[model samples]
Target: MSGETTNETWEEIVVRVLKANEVSLVTYVPDNVLSRLIRLIEADPFFTVVAPAREEEAVAIVTGAYMAGKRGIALMQTSGFATIVNALASLACPFQIPLLLMISERGTLGEFQQGQAIVCRTMRPVLQSLGIEHFAIQERAHVEFVVDGMVRQAFATQAPAALILSPLLTKRAA
Candidate 1:
């Protein structure tokens, strides 16, 4: 076997990668695109999923979990990620927390919402300005390699890393 997934959806691939890496806590604000992954994470006893009213709360929740010696991942949309810029800068980055951010991309090509498109344009620069390393998981074929590698590196450096899920890769979610 090549260890490549065919029938498995990208969301499933994400769940598997997180589980394989022992990511126990998942914090997020509601995102329609991430609902599938959220549901899967919720079903597993190994994962403790938390939904906060706002994205910054999700950041705080994950930060607390990280300080307590638990691995956590924050899942949200691009707009949601924008909301956590301060938290990511003042808290996560300065603290050197190994946070895994899975942001579903918006405000890009084929995006329907004006707000989403606006945020999309700024997503990369926002991440760069904060010195956070981010990558796009824009193809299903690259999910395992890119996600597994990114997750490993985030923990290795004890820094925040993000995987931006492109609408191109997940039309259903988009």
Candidate 2:
């Protein structure tokens, strides 16, 4: 697993983790880094992939899915995270609904977009301020651990939890 030739694609790892967690509903705002993973989820009969027009819409949909007794996860980019702060604070937080957020980390090290950088830099702090628990995954090997741990915490606490995947871990294949 350590060799260069043995690295698993993020889509493969994400599919495995979501299945293992028995996640039935997925809501996402489109993101290139997460596109493959989203496709995999859509192809699987065990998962229902919902693409919303906006990040907050995805949040609201996932929140409703959780209420209906389904396990849910939301996938979005860093800028999307910025857009859903209010929903996270008002709907998700107060309800203590278990939600798994898979966020693509932007605005860091090699980021070129100024607006993305601003939101990316503040994403974690924003989650912290909302009292949302989260973890960042920067390698393929760390994906399962981070995803599993966050899912467990979110379910156990009946609260929203997030796992941020850095660009280093989700880089598109050359």
Q: Which 10 successive residues of model 1 have the least lDDT summed? A: 165-174
- Provide the overall lDDT of each model, using Cα atoms, as 2-decimal numbers: 0.87, 0.83
Per-residue accuracy of model 1 over 1-174 as CA lDDT, tens digit each:
148688888888888888888888999876788888888888889999888899888888988988899999988998888888889889999999988888998788788889888878888998999999999877888999998899899989999999999888877453
Which 10 successive residues of model 2 have the least lDDT summed? 1-10
Residue 129 local lDDT, model 1: 92
Top candidate when judged by TM-score against the true structure? 1
Candidate 1 positional error at 2, Å: 7.1
Q: 106-135, model 2: which lDDT tens digit per residue?
A: 788788889887878789889999999888
Best candidate (score: lDDT): 1
**Model 2 ranges with Cα > 4 A deviation:** 1-7, 172-174
lDDT of 2: 0.83
TM-scores, all candidates, are: 0.94, 0.91
